[model samples]
Target: MSAYAYYPGCSLTGLGKPYDESVRAVFAHLGLGLEEIPDWNCCGATSYMSISGDKAVALAARNLALAEPMGLEIVAPCAACYLVLSKAQHTISGYPEIAARVHKGLQAAGLAYAGRAVIRHPLDVLVNTVGLDAIAAKVIRPLTGCRVAPYYGCQIVRPYSGFDDPLRPQTMDRLLEALGARVVEYPLKAHCCGGSLMGTMEDIGVRMSFLLLKEARARTANMVATACPLCQYNLEAYQGQMRRAYGEDVTIPIVYFTQLMGLAFGLAPKALGIQRNLVTADPLPVTV
Candidate 1:
């Protein structure tokens, strides 16, 4: 079994707790092991970069430094964390001056980052490392009748399109199909879910989320499967507000892809934190 250095960013500890639980449960069910990086810090996500690019790279580099000694590729479940870490790696290697500043920051903290550690999202690990056939083999309860809309939500594919197509990603679609789900045609799969704007710019955020949810519903999808914590939270938690804004009850259970994987793996709902979601919906019926 291959092991990865796991990095669960801030959201996973709080609003995305269910995602954290399901990711762990699903990976364990698949015989994959994850080791949390020791003393790892924040990835300085979207906000930090806008304020100060150098400090943002430095902040993300610290976590990379912590994981370098382990020699395992860092697998982040959070989209923001994955994007930030990947961007930091790219920036440090591409520019000499920025790399020097990042190195100095690490030195001040008595750590050294060689920019050698690989960063990946859990989706990348599952599809590329774990393999779809292996995942399909473990599906004890096929999601036969479930119509799912795979929502990638902007970050994982873009600015770094190595693992999947930037505009039209099929990784999640293919994975869900392997698990026996009826994957729907979701044009807004890679669209923005407004990120932190849901808190600051409520109208714009609600509208963005509503459009995705509305599109999924229009396609007759029962649930929206997401790989990003913020996407899951924004889509699921803001449904009531979205209804008030849009005058339509656009509420569907926005779930983590890992959570669905756990269900398909025959893990109990509690183990996958399925009941923890704010948007309550009947659990997807599993085929025995």
Candidate 2:
């Protein structure tokens, strides 16, 4: 069993609680130990990067600082959390001046920013470290009948580049395949799910979410499996809003890929966070 530093971010406790729970369960099943960073703070995500680059890096650095002394690699499940934290680590490690400033910020909190700890996303740890074969071996309820739309959102795979194959990511699809789920090569899988649009502009967010939902349904997918917590929340929570706003009937369930993985491990749906989904339909498609 491999032990790694875990950072759940803010949304995990709120909108992404299910995702958090599912991830923890799945990782445990795979014999991975996740130690949460004590006194961790938000990664500042997209908004912080736009508002103040240094501050954003500092905030993420604070989390990294907590993990460094412990000599453990940081692993995050949320795509946004993973991206910001990894990107921040990349920035500080590459620039001495920025590293110094980030260190100073951590110092205020009685910490030091030592940019040596490896920062990884949950998918990376699962696919690369644990190996898809391990995940396959643990599956007791294979998703043979389910046709999943593997959504990557935007942050986890892109711009960072080396995390996964950006042009055509296979990590999620491969993981799903290992669990007996059929993959639908969604053309818009990498498209933006209008992240953060919910708080800024409700109308545009509804439309954006509707477009994604409609695309998933058009492809005849059972449900959308996402690596991003924000995407899952937006797609699931706003399905009704999308239908009402567009005057079209839409009922697509949105779920975290980790949750689906947990289900394949024969864990109960409620334990995997399926009960909270807005679409009230079984996400797993019955195989014919």
Candidate 3:
């Protein structure tokens, strides 16, 4: 029953509330507790870094500062938030001058970050800490007939280097299989879902998302599973918009890996936040 400092990020609280609910419900069912860091702020996600380097670093550092005092490992459900927070932690810890500047900024906010805490995506905890064998043991419903396309998005594992195998990531797939899902090799698993471009440059984002959805359907996959809040939000929220843009009525369900795991353990769909999704993909029972 290990617990980590959990940060649900801004999107999970707003645009991806379903993700937050599903992850919480799933982890709780798995006997893990996620302690929300008290007085936490946004990790400077997609916009802050481009706005100003100093502000971006400072904003992310504030989160580390809050988590360090508790001496718990930091976990982020959002890929963008996870990357930004991990990058800030690495940057400040690697450079003395930058560390000093960041400390000053933290002081202004009345926060002190030692940058000593370990930051990881929630999927890492699910695979590494919780262990696949434990997950296998609890799978009351094996996803035998279900074929899942494991989508990694772009930010969570990449650029962090060694967080996951760069070219070949098996974390999500292996976990899914342990829970009895027939994991399909998805070529666009690590491809970018065009992020915030869904709003600005709708065409490109839709094309990217549409292509991925097409690949899943072509592979005979029943659903797409993801570990990031943004990936889930972007892929799920934009399915209809992407269909309209592409002039086709495509209905593919995008889900968080945690949600699938919860279902494998025989947790009800309502408990895992399945009903809140904008897309309509039914959770079929695991035959095995």
Best-performing candidate as measured by TM-score: 1
Candidate 3 differs from the real structure by a C-alpha RMSD in angstroms, to one decimal, of 2.1
Error of 2 at 123 (Å): 1.3
Clashes of 3: 0
Model 1, residue 69: displacement in angstroms? 0.4
TM-score of 3: 0.94
lDDT of each: 0.90, 0.83, 0.82
TM-score for candidate 2, residues paired by index = 0.94
**Each model's total of backbone clashes:** 0, 0, 0
Candidate 3 structure quality by residue, lDDT tens digits, 187-256: 8888888888877888888888888888888888889998777778778888778777888755788888
Write the number of the candidate with greater TM-score, choosing between 1 and 3.
Answer: 1
Estimated TM-score for each candidate: 0.97, 0.94, 0.94
- Pick the winner on lDDT between candidates 1 and 2: 1
Task: Tell me the deviation in Å of residue 123 in model 1.
Answer: 0.7
Cα deviation of 150, candidate 1, in Å: 0.6
Ranking, TM-score, top scorer first: 1, 3, 2
Weakest ten-residue segment in model 3 by summed lDDT: 279-288
Candidate 3 residue pairs in backbone clash: none
